[model samples]
Target: VFELGDSVNQIDTKNESKNKSAIELLKVPKTVKNLKDIKKRKALANLEINSLAKLKALYLSLAENC
Candidate 1:
């Protein structure tokens, strides 16, 4: 069911022991040198996913940031 980009960043494809599921993966950039930030990242992603408008807001927010 996944199209090109949909499958591009799926966490189900990651090793569970090494990566958070996509729902929580947004904050953990792969190159993070400070493990101390993981909790903060997860918390931020959880907050973003808590509501549809928040998710949409993040999507739009990231578009310009990118």
Candidate 2:
């Protein structure tokens, strides 16, 4: 009976470890996707800023000519 109990405990421990590893594996892709989304947003924001700066310059040049 004692040996049987020990064998069950070992199996439970292994199963727990496998479950934890699977959870971690699932989280990795979500983290990577979130990072990619953040990078894409940052790039869009930079483009908007650059475009506004160019428009401001053009407006100033046109006003000077007027």
Candidate 3:
């Protein structure tokens, strides 16, 4: 569950629509193998993919909804 303070950053809390929207904005394929960029591939290989795109989208969604 999302905490009250978390909402200030637009973190979702079991909200299907918000999750869908965030994932769509990411434009990333379901599997890491589908990733094209070498950096992304390496990150995935290391299991360290911190997608700034997705984070931005989530923040935007939160800001919009807030």
On residues 8-59, what C-alpha lDDT tens digit does candidate 1 reach at each position?
Answer: 1342332232334434555556564645566666665455435434444555
lDDT per model vs. reference: 0.46, 0.51, 0.47
RMSD of 1: 11.1
TM per candidate comes to: 0.29, 0.52, 0.28
Stretches of candidate 2 exceeding 4 Å from the true structure: 1-30
Candidate 1 residues lying further than 4 Å off, grouped into runs, are 1-33, 53-66
RMSD of 3: 10.9
How does residue 57 of candidate 2 score in lDDT? 58
> RMSD in Å for candidate 2, one decimal?
27.7
Clashing pairs in 2: none
Name the best candidate (by lDDT): 2
C-alpha-based local distance difference test score of model 2:
0.51
**What's the candidate order when arranged by decreasing lDDT?**
2, 3, 1
lDDT of 3 at 22: 47
- Between prediction 1 and prediction 2, the one with superior TM-score is 2
